[model samples]
Structure formats: structure tokens, C-alpha cells
Target chain A: MRAKTSAALNRSELEEELRAIGRRRYHDRHPFHELLHNGQLGRGQVQAWALNRFYYQRSIPKKDAALISRADSAELRRVWRQRLADHDGDEPGHGGIARWLNLCAAVGLERRKVESLDGLLPATRFAVDAYVHFVREKSLLEAVASSLTELFAPDIIADRMRGMLAHYDFVSNEAMAYFDRRLTEAPRDVDFALEWVLERAETVEQQESVLDALRFKCDVLWAQLDALYHAYVDPGHIPPGAFAPQDESTDRPRRYR
Target chain B: MRAKTSAALNRSELEEELRAIGRRRYHDRHPFHELLHNGQLGRGQVQAWALNRFYYQRSIPKKDAALISRADSAELRRVWRQRLADHDGDEPGHGGIARWLNLCAAVGLERRKVESLDGLLPATRFAVDAYVHFVREKSLLEAVASSLTELFAPDIIADRMRGMLAHYDFVSNEAMAYFDRRLTEAPRDVDFALEWVLERAETVEQQESVLDALRFKCDVLWAQLDALYHAYVDPGHIPPGAFAPQDESTDRPRRYR
Candidate 1:
């Protein structure tokens, strides 16, 4: 863990460690996900997940901008800068954020309130802010390492797209534009990060750190699900000042948004 | 989330946001944590946690050294340099890492194997490296901001100490010395980081970034717990190539080292 006591691991070994971490710990394996994809959650639970997740969606542009600000080279900045455009776009009502907002609207959350983050869970804020901070405050290698969680995102999004669209009437192919774009965009971003981590993390300590960075990023994603599960699933323990479920009177789970 | 549309918030508001993030998103809220603190985890689960956490304890010196390497001023370096000493001491078996190894030994893991990090989870590796890289790559302000997670650590450590000592047969007063030292050491570090962050982050963007940095750090800690919980607690889904339990054939769990 420290002192660089051993010889450097080859890139393949480091990659294997990272892939193993993802396979074992990705949120796709989380029980909340099992509940989600299997169509076991109610509408209100689904609504709560979407509302809280909006905080994450809204944060991507800030994270991308921070990465751009930190990169020293023009080429690096130029290649990476596309992320900001991909999330924010040239005009209002376009791109990923807009699509996320459309999803929120489809689920019955008001855009202004969502923008204000008035009902956003503290867990959502913490998780999203962590990501933006991870991009801004880690080394370029580490920052890219953190983004490696994207390697697994396409599968999760596809699961989500298939599950939500099929199970929830509120979900539509149009509302899933955010995920559709991500299916394309995340792969490109991940390819860059994977190559960057492989090439730059040359020493044993550096390679271990890079592998760990991806795991840390996975935790970031997984923790969000834990929060959602705690707040909206079986336990339903909502924290103070988080978004409240609209229907709380019944012993049985209510229909979710 | 982008463009910094509003003027800077008052410092109190910024502080509130930071505190709120911690209150809501810190690992103290994770259920696996609740289980650990309540002494509900089996010995094997506890062993797995201690073994993996050794990786975190081992990385502190490297993170401190990285912070020292990135700072510009003698004053900043002088203040931060104590961290390396606190963790490394004058020789082998002298400092925080040594104390942590002692704790590992007390908990029944071999000090040598723990140091080897041969059985560490990929998640554990990822979270620890993120902290080290955060120190090495981020702006001085953001680096300090990331360390502010220490501000919340004392309470959690105190809880763990009380719970583990009271509940677990193998844990003892000597084993808790690492956390005891942290109870003192963390305060000094947190004071510097909190004061530095409050004083230096002048713009709204800077302050928000600082706040987000702390939140990012909380996620890092929380993510580690998520990994621990998934591997050892309720789902008990250990990742491939991670440390395995000593006994798996019976319905009942067994004592582990």
C-alpha cells in the first residue's frame, strides 16, 4: 500500500485487478439494482431514484470543466473538452443535462425545483460533489483513473434502459436520451482513460494507485445506490431534508414515479 | 452545476454545505457500518475488514509525502511534513503504520502478509490511492480541502473503538492505539485544512469546489465501507482474487485471522 517495496506490475496485471474490482463491486451487482431491473420497486421509489440521480446528471458539466481547467496541454484540453459539450451542448434544451431534465419532467419533478436542488437528497449531493471534486483535485492520471468506472456504465445503462422502459410507464425511449447518448459517449471517454491509465501508470505504486482510482470511482457510483436503497427501498429511512415520498400512508409500497 | 451563475455564497453557507454533506453522506450512515459498530459482524467479516483496511493505514505516509512534494512554501511544507513523520516515524515498527500493523497482529493477521498487501481488495486499493493522488495532483487548496475528511473521522473512530472493544473478543486497548493517535493527530490536520479552505477559497467557484472536494473525500471513505459491506456483510459477495474466508463449508461462521 505504501513505500513501493515491490517491483512494478505489468499493465495486464493492473488491468486485471481493475476489471476484477468492477466485476465484484459495480452497482450493477447491488441489490437495489436487482430490485430496480427486476421491476420490483414501486413508482414512488423509482421517482426518488430519478430525482436524486438528477443531481449526478447535473454535475457532469462541472466535473468536465474542472478537468479541462486542470489539464496543462492544449491537445489534452482539446480532446477532453468535448465532454463539456457532450453534457452541456451549444444551446439550452439540448444535450445530456436537458435529456436528464426531460426524464425528471416525465417522472413528475419540476425542472426549477430540480435545478434548485431543493428536494435532492444529501446523499445525492455528496456523491455528485465527490465526482466533480475527484476530477478537479486528483492527478491527471488519477482523474482519468476515476473516470474508468465508465467502462461498466454502458452495461448498467443498458440494463436501466431495458428495465425502466419496459417496466415503468413513465419511462420512454425519448426520456432515455441521456442514457442513449451515454452509451456512445462513455465508451469513447473510457477508451481514452483506459489507455491513459495504462500508459502513464508505469511504476508499481502508480499502477496500484490507478487501479485503486477506478475502484474508488466504482465506490462513488455504488454508494449512490446504497443511498437510494436506504432512502427509498425496503428500509425507506429518509434523512432529514431529503426529498420525501409523495405517498407515505400505506403499509404496502406505493406506485413510484 | 456549471458556469458559476451566482455570486459567491457567504462563508457560513459554504460551511453549512460542507457539514451537511458530511452529515448526510459519510460512511457512518452505511448499514454495514451500523453492523460493524453494533458487533453484529462475524469474526471472519471483521478479519476481512481489518486486513483490507491495513492497506489504507499503510498509505498515509505516501499521501503526506505527496502533499509535501506539491506545496510551494516552506511554511506549508513545514506544517504538512509532520504527517509523514506521524505515519513513518524514525524507523521500521515506530510510527502510525507500525501501530496499525500492531493492531492487525492483535486482530490475528500476520504483520508481514498485511504489509505485503497480497490479499487486499481492489476497492481498498482504489480508495487509498485516490487520496494519495489527490494530494499530488490537486491545487494546494483542494489538497487541503480533501484532507478535511479528517474533521469527521474522530467520531467514527471513537464509535468503532467503543463498539469493537466492547463486542469483539480479539480486539483490545493496545489494538486501538492507532485510532487513539488519530484522535489527536487528525484534529491538528483538520484545523489547518478547514482554516486554510475557509481563508483561501475566495470565489464562489473556488468555495464550491472546495466543498465538493470534501464531499468527494467523504465518498472515498464511504466507498471503502461499501466495498467492505458487499464483500463481508449482507450480500457477502467477495470479489474474485480478494481475500477469502477461512471456513466456508458450514452454515455457521468461524473465527478468522
Candidate 2:
């Protein structure tokens, strides 16, 4: 029985170790990131990625608000409110979501079409919805731990920003502006979230839940890219209702109006 | 406005059109069916498909129960109750879900692992959950209409059962018993559901809503296969936490037990 008790502590250590698993294995290191940053992807691929990824950006604030509403403590809610502002911003034509729209436009997707998410893959929608549902249903510690993926995001954003400006002809400092803010925002966000997990995950079970949350979040991120790579990169088996890449030489037909 | 209005149809015609949609687009024609029936899929792929698809079958009774609970009329509830019985069975080890477990055991998966859904794709869970949510939230008429996918299921089951026993060396009549029962159960349920939709969808708006329900049901079915194809059949881009196919020839040393 004492050995079993010691095993429980070992399990908590194992759970913290699994949280570190996300830092190494998540898509922050995927080859597509390298291509996306280096501007090596064709305009069509870039358009596809941005259009598909817009769904993720659009959902973040909604899920964050969901988490905010579920928080029982004022301090927790107060800490969570920053995500809402970061995504929605204080004024029109600002915030993370708008910045994502600018990225979409820069990549050549029509603003209306991008906003509609008509062209986004169903898998992307499913993955994002799964994330939202996880936040709503899982324990608050796990919900907060899921966002710990942000702990690793700042480094990727730095790589992406430098790579995009150097490689892509269409990219401008203004159009690639989302990453610039995230460079600072992500670290601040990550610090608070990491501290929250380390401080609050006091039990073996809580530690396991937090670890599972990060793993779930990693799956969420990886599934999005898997859909993108499958649809746009490899066999390119585009499912029905997903976004179709526009012909490089052509534009939206006038008759669509 | 007049051109848009012209597409509206009377109730009988709308019911026929909705059934026609099921006839044309259901999973009966999916290549995976051909593969499964012909015994062409390798054992691992077959195991992967069954493990993943169990998530769908397991959720059916829950969704049916939700629909049954939402139903206002006794006659409607009585008709819907058959689906619950079909899936859940009169006792343990007798119903569709149990029969599905038998199939899993025949394929060599441990019953506990299969039950836990440890290996199922994340997208499969989301798609199944989406169906349950649709039934819970939509109008009763639409929920009944969604089950009209069963309108197409009987024919597929006939082909599947005959083909599996004829072609698959590993399969037995006992192993494929789930399909045998579904042959009778699906048609009976579908006929009642079709009549229910036809009788209730009197308004043009109601008719359109029923059609939309069938479309949504089709999406649910198609999305499940899409996830399967993406994960197991294509390049096998298995998402994190999903079941990974094991090598049959080399049994790994058991670490968990």
C-alpha cells in the first residue's frame, strides 16, 4: 500500500513529463511551418492554409469566452479576459481575428469567402469544435493547461515572422502583423498559464488531467495540419464542401456576383 | 425573388426528393464498403476500421434515446423506440453494439481497449457528437428525417453480408452477425421514419427542413468515412491518441499490465 502511494507520486511526475511531451512533438516543428515561413509554398497553398487556419483563429476567442463564463473566481476571469481583447480588440479593423483576415487577404483569399469558412476543410471544423467542447466540458485546470501550448508558440512565431518577410514576395510587414503581436502576447499568456498549471495541479489526478489536456490540444493542432497537408499537399483528396484553390492566372468569375 | 420561390414544392414531392437524395449519395457506394466486402483490406486496416467505426455504432443508441426523449407524441416515440432496442438489445451480449463487440473480438482487439475508444480518431468522436447534438437540438420532424439514412442502409447490409462471408477467409457467419440483424431492423425503422416525415412535413418550410436533415445525416456518415480514409486508408496519417495499427507478426512486450 505504501508502494502504491509512492507510485501515485511517480504518476504525477509522469504527467508533468507528458506536458513536456507537447513542447517537443507538436506541429510547431512541422515542415510545413518551415515552408510557410520561408515563402516556399505556392500562392494557392498559402491561400489554402490561411483560409483553413482562419477557422482556428476565429474559434479561439469564442472558446476563450466560453472558458471565461465558466470560471468561478474573479482573478481567473480577470486573467482570461485578456484573450477576449486580444482576439476581438478594442476597435473595428483590429485584434487577432482581423489580423488573421489581413493575412488571408494577403494570401489572395477573398475576405468574404474566408470569413464564410465555406472553403475550409470539414476536418478543420471538427478539430476546432473539439477544442471548444474540451474547454467547456473539461475541468478548469485541464482547460487552462490546454492553452499551455502557447508556451512554445513564441519561438515558432519568431521563426515564422522572419521567414515570411525574407521569403514571400506578397508578404508585407503590415500583412504579416499577427505574428508580431503574438511574439510578446504569447509569452505573457504562456507565463501566466504555465504558472497556473504548476501552482494549481496539486494532486496526481489533477496533474494527469493537465497532461491529457495538453495532449488533446496537440491533437487539435496536428489534426488541422493533417487536413491541410492531405487536401493541399500530398494526395490532395479534397472532401466535398472544402475550399478549392483558385487558379493562379484567374480571378473569381464576375457572374458570381 | 420569384425565381427563388419557384424551387418550392408540395409535401409528397419534397419527401420523394429527400429519399432520392439518400438513394444517390449514401455510404453504400463508398470504396471502403467494396474493400470491406471483398476482403481486400489487410487485417490491420480492417481492425482499424472496426475499432474506429465502433465509436459510431456505440453512439447510435444514445442519439436515438435523445430523439426519443425529445419526441412529444406517443406514436412517434413508439416508432423511435425500436432503434433503441435494436442497438441496446434486450440484454447484454445480444444487441447491435454487443454484436459489434463480437466482431471486434473476432478481429483480435481486447474488449476493454475497444470499449474505451482509446484508438478511435478524434474526428470520429466529433462527427458522432455532432449527430447527437443535431438530434437533441433540431425539430422532431427533422430528427426523424435524419434517421432516414437507414432508408439506404438495408440494401447496403444485404450486399455487405453476402460479400463478406463469400470473400473473407477470416470472417464467419457468427462474426458477421451484426449485419444480419440490421438487414431487418433498418428497413422497418426507415419505413416508419419516412412515413413520419411525409405526414408531418406539410409546409414548404417544413419540407425544406426535412430535406436539410437528410443532407445533415449524409454529412455525418460521409464525415466518418472521411476521417477513416484520412487516418487508416490513405497514407495513414493517424492523429495523436487514435488507435495505431499493430504489427501482427511481432507482438510487443506488454508494458501496461
Candidate closest to the true structure, highest DockQ: 2
Residue B222 C-alpha lDDT in model 1: 69
- TM-score result, candidate 2: 0.89
Where is the poorest 10-residue window by lDDT in model 2 chain B?
B248-257
Best candidate according to lDDT: 2
lDDT of 2 by residue, A48-155 (tens): 888888999999998999899898999889988999999999998899999999998987778998897776776777788889988988898889999988867877
lDDT of 1: 0.77
Which of the CAPRI classes, incorrect, acceptable, medium or high, describes model 2? acceptable
The recovered share of true contacts, given per candidate in order, is 0.03, 0.28
* Tens-place lDDT digits, model 2, residues B1-257: 12324556666677678767876668776666777888777677778878888999999999999998997889888878888888898998889999999998887788999998886777777778878878888898888889888878877888888887887666788988998888888888878888878888876677778887887787677767766666677656676556777766676521111
Model 1: how far residue B138 lies from native, Å: 7.1
Report, for every candidate in turn, its global Cα lDDT versus the true structure.
0.77, 0.78
